[model samples]
Target: MTAREPRLLVVDDQALVRSGIVGLLEAAGLEVMGEASDGFEAIEQARRLRPEVVLMDIRMPGLDGIEATARLMAMPEPPRVLVLTTFDLDEYVYRALQVGASGFLLKDAPPDRLVDAVRTVARGEALLAPALTRRLIERYLAAPAPGVLAAPATELTPREREVWQLIAEGLSNHEIGARLYLSEATVKAHLTRLFVKLDVRDRVQAVVVAYESGLVRPGAQRATH
Candidate 1:
């Protein structure tokens, strides 16, 4: 039996960009569920299509992408959103994360990178590109939040805390598994535990807790994945 491809919704005002992304994603053997030309349409299509991932643009006509993303996330079972935009739209990257986007990507990301992003989101992993991840975090820190250490320290088990620290350092499940000499399933179990204990939706938010809670210090060298 053939494996079913993950369904994707490509949302961009630019027809060419949407088409190109759909083509790249489909060529990589994933399913393109639908396409939308604007944020309003994207939200409507996402509801109807029930895609696993929504490749969304930051700026769009009518409702902006950030608002659309926020609204979508409020759904009963929302799809993961990947902020895919051009270099000129980097300003919106931080806002996209604030709106609960699971990851960020360049519209010009290589074909493999785009494919990998779809797979990552389908697997319930955050799509934080290493470069964009740091940039988005720095933007948040520069403004300085009220330092809400929302994730309580005692809620995390000793093993779960170790996993959370590694996540803050940007380690993937496979890398964490290898480092701890545990199976990937064990690593994922720990991650799930951490997420529940912290009430976080993804690793991006977990990293925020790490910083706010002083679990991981800024400027500290993270383990290379």
Candidate 2:
């Protein structure tokens, strides 16, 4: 049987941009479940529609995407959020990821890339590129926010810690498995346990936890097991 297309909620303050995005996704054969003009409506629509993914804009007039992403994550069953931004290194993008955004995309990204991003996040995977992930996290950490503390990773087993480090280094499950001489299924199993231990919902959050908690330092050489 064929898999079902992911239902999406497109949220942007600009009507033209929102329409264009909706058109692109629909053309790509994805379901456009709803659209919202601002963060408030995004939250309401998400609650009512319960789409599988949300394509969010960062600088909406009210509430804004970061807070909206946070609120959505607090729901019992939150939709995966792929934040849209004009700049790849936008600080708001980092903040969104911290608040449970599944990933981010550049507004001017190719249509195919955008579609892939939505699908990737909808499938419960983060869409951040490895290089971009490191750069963004490193830049954000330079002026780290006050009062935001990393959750301790002491509860994670040694093997799980190894997996977590690989993830922070931007390795995919397949790559991580190859690097650690484990199967992909085994890698996923470790990730599942890691998420529970760290109280993060997805890979992006896990990466944030790794950096914020200082379990993996940016620019430091990866430790060999």
Candidate 3:
């Protein structure tokens, strides 16, 4: 049987940008559930259509992407959010990640990359990969944000702390398991416990916690214990 196409919700305040993205995605053979011009509408459409992924624009009129992402994540079964922004260093992108976005894509990225990003998030993999995301965090969110834990590094067990650092270093679960000489299943178990202890919704937020709490610092060598 053929696999189902990923269902997507395109949310952007600009009509042209939204139209362009939806056209490209549809051309790429993905299913477009609906489109919304603002965050509030994004939320309403998302709840009603239950798309698998949301292509969210950071700057919207009623509610911004960050706030809208937070609300979407709070739903019983939330769609993965992939933020889009003109600039990679846009501060709002960092906030959206903290609020549970799966990853982000540059607004000007080639159409192929945009389609790939949606598929990647739909498959439940992080779109930003840790290294690139680490740089963004280091550059923009190194200082404490209102919602992140700045001093909670001490709360983690030695192993959990190690996992967090590896995650911040952009290591995948399989890579982390190989690095630590543990099985991938064990790594996922640690990740689950890590998420609960850190109060993060996903790996992106967990990485945020790692940096915000000073568990990992940019440019520092990652050491294996």
Q: What is the C-alpha RMSD of each candidate to the true structure, in Å?
A: 2.7, 3.0, 3.5
Query: What shift in Å separates residue 219 of candidate 1 from its native position after superposition?
Result: 3.0
Off-target runs (Cα >4 Å) in candidate 2 are: 142-152, 222-225
Write the residue-wise lDDT of candidate 1 on 191-216 in tens digits. 88888888778887777667667676
lDDT of 2 by residue, 30-86 (tens): 999999998999999999999999999999897999999999999999999999998
CA lDDT, candidate 1, residue 175: 86
- Tens-digit per-residue lDDT, 90-168, candidate 3: 7788888888999999999999999999998998777885656867888886554434445455577788878887888
Q: After best superposition, candidate 2 residue 124: deviation in angstroms?
A: 0.9
TM-score winner, 1 or 2: 2
User: What order do you get sorting by lDDT, best first?
Assistant: 2, 3, 1
Q: Could you give me the TM-score of model 2 versus the true structure?
A: 0.93
List TM-scores for all candidates, in order: 0.86, 0.93, 0.85
Among these predictions, the greatest lDDT belongs to 2
Best by TM-score: 2
